[model samples]
Target: MKTISQVSIFIENTKGRLANVCGLLGDNNINIKALTIAETPEFGILRVVLNDTEKAKKVLKENGFIAKIAPVVAVEVSDTPGGLAKALKVLADNDINLEYMYGFVEKASEKALMVLKFDNVEKAIDILQKNNVSIVDDKVALGL
Candidate 1:
């Protein structure tokens, strides 16, 4: 799959705080392509992949949120069992460490997409291809 910028915003673990951040995006016309929220006892990291990452970053910064952007790979795979395992095995075989990941498929598409954050992207890509693992490209992802 293609590599996209993932913006992680650290927010206070309070009720409505997440809603507020999401509302801001809506108000600014930013569309979230995919999102995941990982929480710790102290705070929550809102990981978002959006249509306009730069604009989203600017908006978050202007609103006083601690945000960081990093590259992540999105891969589309079969929706059935072992799809995730197959992907994971490829990376494991090469000793690539996956920091985190999450994704889903459109109800219409049958194939699921996985957004993976790894330690080394280039190596990960190489390993994936060497193992015949298909990485979804930007064009394919955008349906271009």
Candidate 2:
């Protein structure tokens, strides 16, 4: 697992908004490691972990998108029933507040990727290490 810069974009809750934002990143060659869209009636929060975070943010901003960058931990956990529960318990024991989270598993794999937005990142990292939580780097995640 590793600490990555996550870009959160506030977009209007419309069909084409997501496509436009994604297209901008794609055009700039910023690979999205993980992404999720949490929508309400008025707006949507698009959380993205990108390979080129700065570039993505710049492009988004130039295109009139409201974006913010923050540090998040990308963890690779087992894709089992209690996998997320185990991780959440570790954070809870340390009193780390999880602001937001998103993830997905590789097709046909037992491993899953999780992006955790927490209150105290360093503390959370220490807690995870103390609890023997394995973190997958970019290379490890992509099997590169």
Candidate 2 regions exceeding 4 Å error are 105-110, 138-144
Cα RMSD of all models vs. native, in order, equals 2.1, 2.4
lDDT of 2 by residue, 1-144 (tens): 467777899999987888988888988987776888888998999998777777887888898999999888878678889988999998888788988888843522467778788888888888888898876665555444
TM-score of 2: 0.85
Candidate 1 residue lDDT tens string, 45-89: 999877677889999999999899998887877889998899898
Clashing pairs for model 2 are: 1-135, 1-136
At residue 13, candidate 2 shows an lDDT of 90
What's the TM-score of each model vs. the native? 0.90, 0.85
What local lDDT score does residue 85 receive in model 1, on the 0 to 100 scale? 95
Which pairs clash inside model 1? Answer: 1-135, 1-136, 2-136
**Candidate number with greatest TM-score:** 1
lDDT of each: 0.82, 0.80
What value does the lDDT take at residue 70 in candidate 2? 87
